[model samples]
Target: MATYDPFRDLERLASSFLETGRRGPREMPMDLYRAGDHYVLSTDLPGIDPGSVDIDVDGQLLTIRAERTLTTDDSAQWITRERTGGTFLRQLSLGQGLDTERITASYNNGVLNVTIPVSEKAKPRKIEITTQDGQQQIESTTA
Candidate 1:
């Protein structure tokens, strides 16, 4: 004979309720860092279709969106359906000095990588300083 656990059943019921309440879009986890003259932003989007991924920039705001769909078989019984199917969204406010026009993104291995290059006016360069003695010295400075 199989044993019946009321507590386990109650817990499962509560979990189901909570999961059903979360029908809205979820946020995509990401990591961002500055690399040389560019910024790299990587987001994790496992189980998401590459064709559903969309990236856009509006002014200084950058938005990323994707979707995951779960195919269900009505005749099959589900033991535990923990994986969720919904839209994934993330937005960021880019600071000044970034080359938004040259931004690029790629999706590979369930990861989305975005590269934002620094504008020419924001890059560091060597400036020639002329002294009163008519000698010129090179000084490294950031614009």
Candidate 2:
């Protein structure tokens, strides 16, 4: 019989859920992808200014914090209110394969694009074999 480590699984599942949660209710919904030697994180932040958004990286964790201010005229009445705007914090633990120092970010068109360049040691390298008197050898080293 085998036993389950619920705590670890729960933590992993919770992390995964937080990474792929729904939009709107989730602040700064991001789409992450691997492009060549870099990882791309594109987030949708409608009605939010880039200046108001703050990005922080600590070790492998990345946090995006933003505050939204709402205003209305005195004559305006709120008959129905569903859009509750306020400050929100979102964070993700990036993989060790990333080069945190070289991370580049840009905000445009209501979308924030973050480019995480993979570390040289994290990228794939191809090795070739050469015959030297019936001996095999590696051709190159890359990361």
Candidate 3:
């Protein structure tokens, strides 16, 4: 025999209310950081098909999209269904001095990795200084 639990029913009602009208794309968690002359962005996408991953860069905007689908069996009984399956999306506004043309991305172990390289004009460079006596001196500077 199953015992009556008011708390469980209340929790289920609250969850249903919170999840209602949430049919749009879900947001995926990501981490971005700079390592030397390049930036790396790592995003979590477990149980997602690698082929469904799509990434695009339009000017200074970078967009990432993916989809996840769960299979259900008609004869099998489900006790709980907490995991959601739907489209996941994330977008970022890229700053200047980045080589967008050379950007690359790869997926591995349910994590997507993106590499953004710094443009040559944006890298730190040395400047050559000329003295009054026509002598040349080298100085460190950033561009």
Candidate 4:
């Protein structure tokens, strides 16, 4: 049993008209996770041209923008067209420990992958301990 909601269809119609090439467009779906010393973010932008994708970082904010357009022929009609083409936007707030300068992004198979490396200063390191009295020597490796 499926519920018929007229508002949902109206909302979808409004969104298709509202989204433009500018900002405030619909955002692409994504999944972010941490892997070892880096964080990986994967976003889905199906049927989008690779040249239309853009990634920019300012301060601690990372913004990803892309556009998809629906191409049609006048002869083809009388069918359902659910895939609305519009701009996609996504922003991420980076943390202090992230290495923003070396962030890399790649697009393949309609998916965009962004890798953010962790800063070296934030990684675990061994600290040496020593005695100031000059009579005792202590050597320890703490990871």
**Which candidate comes out best when scored by TM-score?**
3
Please write out the lDDT profile of model 4 over residues 1-143, one tens digit for every residue. 99999999899777655553334578889999999999999999999999999999999999999989888788988355667677889999998988999999999999999999999988877665667865546666554
Query: What does candidate 2 score in Cα RMSD to the true structure?
Result: 12.2
- Taking all chains together, each candidate's TM-score versus the true structure is 0.83, 0.69, 0.85, 0.79
Candidate 4 global lDDT: 0.87
Instruction: Report, for every candidate in turn, its global Cα lDDT versus the true structure.
Output: 0.92, 0.78, 0.92, 0.87
Model 1 residue 93 lDDT? 99
After TM-score superposition, what is the CA distance of residue 28 in candidate 4 from its true location, in Å?
A: 0.8
18 in model 3: Cα distance from truth in Å?
4.0
Segments of candidate 2 deviating more than 4 angstroms: 1-26, 128-143
Tens digit of lDDT per residue, candidate 1, span 1-143? 98999999999889888976898889988999999999999999999999999999999999999999999999999888888888889999999999999999999999999999999989887787788997986565655
- State residue 46's C-alpha deviation in candidate 1, in Å: 1.0
In angstroms, how far off is 25's CA in candidate 3? Answer: 0.4
Error (Å) of candidate 1 at residue 54 is 0.6
The segments of candidate 1 whose C-alpha lies over 4 angstroms from its true place after superposition are: 1-13, 131-140
lDDT score, candidate 4, position 65: 93
Give residue 94's lDDT in candidate 1 (0 to 100).
98
TM-score of model number 3: 0.85
Candidate achieving higher TM-score, 1 or 2:
1
The superposed Cα distance between candidate 2 and the true structure at residue 82, in angstroms, equals 3.3
Candidate 3 local lDDT, 115-134, one digit each (tens): 99999999998887888997
